[model samples]
Target: VVGAVVSITGVSSTVTSFGTTVRSDLVLQNENHMFLDISLWSDIARNLNGQELAVLGRSGPVMLAVCSLRVTGATKGGYSLTSTPGTRCVLNPVSEMAHLVQS
Candidate 1:
């Protein structure tokens, strides 16, 4: 699917005033109108929109869209993060890692 991230689910809201553990499930589709499923954590809270993500199934490659997002699930107290967020925190935009190969 080439469509954008139409929805996000499974986020815990019962966190402390400070950050807490959580998980986010996403929905993606494309021009062909196929749906893809993805999950991410709160760490990417700031910079994940409009980024390109790819996955392969029995078919060919597909792109995941991430537009508007909704945080779901309930929070109670600090527990070990079920699924770790993409990044607990953001890294330097121009860090030396940019020179490293990715994918």
Candidate 2:
């Protein structure tokens, strides 16, 4: 897994799997131009305000922008979070698995 200290840009936007328009989370680059997109499978993210975090990635990480999260006061299993940049993101790891999990 690739580990890096990235600034938590914010929680992700709501995306419909339908149609041709693709959607994902947004994280700003450490230097210049554009955002990096990352896919979050669970309701495991939220918005951050210019907070930097140490993160270890999982699966096939994206190259466009960063992360996402389920919103506060949002209904269960519902995606209604607005794009909140500079939001902080938290990363967690499961304790059950062993070295069997790797990139």
Candidate 3:
């Protein structure tokens, strides 16, 4: 799903999914405010800020296109993984993804 990263805490990264936009508790933060102690993807053991990413879930149709992520220090509730800086990934809508692929 295509959306923006509203907030990033020690545990979870909140994304606002596009279309119909059903608000899920999975949303740690949004265009508005931040929520603490939310669960996050195990693979996301690092901080992502001002970066866009296409996260492929291990299972289910839950794919997150995240951007504007800010990494905070480790918290007791946060995922237990090392945080390393990396190049940001850009997330585009399906149409945009297809266009880029075709180009």
Candidate number of the best TM-score: 1
Off by over 4 Å in 3: 12-27, 32-94, 98-103
| Candidate lDDT values, in order | 0.33, 0.35, 0.32
Pick by TM-score: 1 or 3, better one: 1
Listed per model in order, the count of residue pairs whose N, CA or C atoms clash below 3 Å is 9, 19, 2
Write the residue-wise lDDT of candidate 1 on 75-103 in tens digits.
Answer: 36522223222322111212343333232
How many residue pairs of model 3 clash at the backbone? 2
Cα deviation of 74, candidate 3, in Å: 27
Candidate 3 vs. true structure, TM-score: 0.23
The regions of model 1 sitting more than 4 angstroms off are 1-21, 45-103
* Top-down lDDT ranking: 2, 1, 3
Least well predicted 10-residue stretch by lDDT in candidate 2: 57-66
Best by lDDT: 2
* Steric clash pairs (candidate 3): 49-69, 52-89
Candidate 1 lDDT score at position 4 = 30
lDDT of 3 by residue, 65-86 (tens): 3223333334468542222233
Tens-digit lDDT track of model 2 for 1-103: 1223244566455465554224434443322222334444223333322242324333323221233333322345744344344334323323333232331
For residue 12, what is the lDDT in candidate 2? 52
